[model samples]
Target: MKQRHEVLFKQLESYRSYVLSVMENVTEEEAEIIPFGFKNNIRWNLGHMYLDQYLWIQAVTKEKCGVPEQFKSWFGFGTTPANFNSETPSLEELKNLLKEQPAKIKDVYGERLEEEFPPTEMGMHTIEQVLIRTIFHEGMHLQAILDLKKCIQPSF
Candidate 1:
C-alpha cells in the first residue's frame, strides 16, 4: 500500500499540474464567471480543491492544516462561488498554492503513509488510504473544472 501511495503522490503532482495547465491564461473575470448552467467558477474550484485537500489530509494524518483560517468560510464544501468576495485568494495566489501543495503533501507525509486515521468518518485506516481517496476527489474536480472551462473558455 505504501508503494502504491508513493506512486500516487507523484501522480497527484502530475494531475495538479495538468489542472493548472488547463487553467492558465484565464483572467480573473474569466476565472470568476459562472457559466450559464454551472454553480461554481474556475476560481472557486481551485480554492475548494486547496481547502478540501487540506481538510482531508489533516483528517487522516496528524499534520497541521496548511491554509488560512478563512478558507473554511469561502472554500469549504457546500460553500458557493457566489459568495466569493474580496478576501478570496487571487488567481495567481490560488495557482501558487495549488502548484506547491502536492509537493508539500509529499514532504510531510511521504514516508508517514502508514499513520492511523484520526477517528475520521470515512472509515479509512491509514493516511495513505485517504490520500488515495483524495486522488479520485481531485480528479473529479479536475473534470468539473475542465467542463467549466469548456463552457466559459477552452483549454489554453
Candidate 2:
C-alpha cells in the first residue's frame, strides 16, 4: 500500500475510534431516543454510517460489498427509526459491525485506493475519493450522535 493510503486508513481508524468512544456509555434505550428537533436517533446515525460506506463504495466499484439487505430500509438516507422493525439490528450488533469495519476496509481495499472507476454523479472515480467522502459523511453522523447524546443525557 502507498504511504498516502496508509495515512488515510490511519485517519479513518482514528475518526471511527472517536465515534465509538462517544457511543461507549450509551445504553440501548438511550440509543433509541429521537429527541426533539432531531430526525433520527444515535442508533440510526450509527447504522447509517456503517451502511453509507458500503453504498458509496459499491456505487463506485459497481460491485456489492456485503452490506445486509435490510440496512437500506433501516438506515438509508431519509430513513427514520419509525421505519425500523424488529429486524433492525440492535445497538450492540451495529457497534460490533462498526468496530470491525475499518480494518475490514483496509484489508479489502488498501491496495486499490487509486484504482479509478467511471465517475458517479458526485464525480468520485477512485477508491480513495470514495473513502474521503465516506469519512466526511461519518463525521457528519458523528456530530449527530453527539447531539443525540446531549439530548438523551443532559448531563453528558
- True-structure Cα RMSD, model 1: 2.1
Q: Which residue pairs collide, candidate 1?
A: none
lDDT of 2 at 95: 94
Which residue runs does candidate 2 get wrong by more than 4 Å?
none
- Point out the worst 10-residue segment of candidate 2 by lDDT: 143-152
Q: Rate the local accuracy (lDDT) of all candidates.
A: 0.81, 0.93
lDDT per residue as tens, model 2, 63-149: 889998889999998899998999999999999999999999999988888998999999999989999999999998998898888
Candidate 1 — worst ten consecutive residues by lDDT sum?
147-156
Evaluated with TM-score, which candidate comes out highest?
2
Tell me, by lDDT, which candidate is best.
2
Q: Candidate 2: lDDT over CA atoms? A: 0.93
Error of 1 at 147 (Å): 1.2
Q: Residue by residue across 1-156, what tens digits does model 1's lDDT show? A: 367776888788888989899877788888888878888888888988888877877776656776787898888888887677788898889999999998888887788778666667878767677777877888888888878778776633
In model 1, which runs have C-alpha deviations exceeding 4 angstroms? 154-156
